[model samples]
Target: MAESNIHTLVHKETITLFPVDYRISRHAIFLINRNNIDSPLPLLSEIMRSKGFKVTTDQEKADYIMRITSYVTMPTNKNDQALPYSAEFLLSMREKLPVIKPLLVQSGDSPGEQMKATAKLVHNSNQGILGSDASNIISLGSTFGGGAGGLIAGAAASVIDTTASIFSRNSIREGLAGFEFSMTKNSGFLNQVSGLNVYAASATPEKPEALLDAAIGRAAAEMERD
Candidate 1:
């Protein structure tokens, strides 16, 4: 009995987020370079690796790409304005590949309690959006600061919603809610001026390894059905 040459080539991808507001450059720099400083890129990569997938930082080497866009706000208005925040994720898989499919996920939120509200919208609207259940979805990990927290929360919620929307425009189970938890309390003048600085990326989806596998697996299964 000779060993079978059965190997799975898990394609690579990137995840990135970008803030639209130019006023918060300082906060964005701190979030990326300092504060909870470490880059989210490595975190995502490690997650993907745990799922038996190859992770890469080079776009040229990747099979797919995931981009995230987020907005954070620190209120300067006395009316307790509900600052608007959003997260846009674009997951692109190889068009010609047999085991993978491309996808795009986007989400947004307003200020106040709505910022924390985590109701999976797109999934609830239809079926075939997610990978059969909540467990199939990817958890990007936690972030600090109210603004950042809100942005991450909004994005996560949006991903769930968009995932559902992609599968079935009318899914029953709204993916998951309130997944984003804060690591620090809002304080200091810096917090006031800083608010939440938005950060986004357009990288290969090699990070957050679990997410990459789950997404790829889902796409693969969907492709088989087609």
Candidate 2:
């Protein structure tokens, strides 16, 4: 692993809080209740910008008025019809703390030509959170930030087999992410769900918040496709 690449894993992040009053920017967007310092909101904003959904105040001109909420669901067990294949993952990499990357971004059918489009897609490997489960939603707070994140990363790094040193990016994609959206208002095709629904992680062993984040990212990436 190149030293330069390692920097991607750990870098500086300024926890910018959403405007308590209203989000006003040249790009119109109204983000509601996504205040978690470490969360899908930050990830969502990144996705919206990448997809041409400008972020700003002046809901009058906004393409999408999105309200994001994080929810926790019932736990899963071996017998519970195994989570959708997309939500499960396992990683065995030489670099234990390699920076986790975002979902593979791709432009999809835009809600409208003006609001729907995506930028270049770039990323490494990790989970299968692409268009997966619903009811088995989970919380991601521990995976991305707290101690569990640290522990999970550390474990993957050390899981390398000593005898069979050939660890060719052993990975299991986690697609255990889903959302429920409903639009309240629509003047143009650009106006999407009145509410953007996204959940956290399940109680599984390796619920990378990135998956949930990626789930949100993937949805936003493909949201606008005409």
Residue 150 displacement (Å), model 2: 10
Q: Weakest 10 consecutive residues, lDDT, candidate 2?
A: 114-123
TM-score of 2: 0.32
Lowest summed lDDT over 10 consecutive residues: which window, candidate 1?
174-183
Error of 2 at 35 (Å): 10
Candidate 1: misplaced stretches above 4 Å? 1-40, 68-226
lDDT of each: 0.25, 0.29
TM-score for each candidate, following the candidate numbering: 0.22, 0.32
Cα displacement (Å) at residue 213, model 2: 4.5
Roughly what TM-score does model 1 have, to 2 decimal places? 0.22
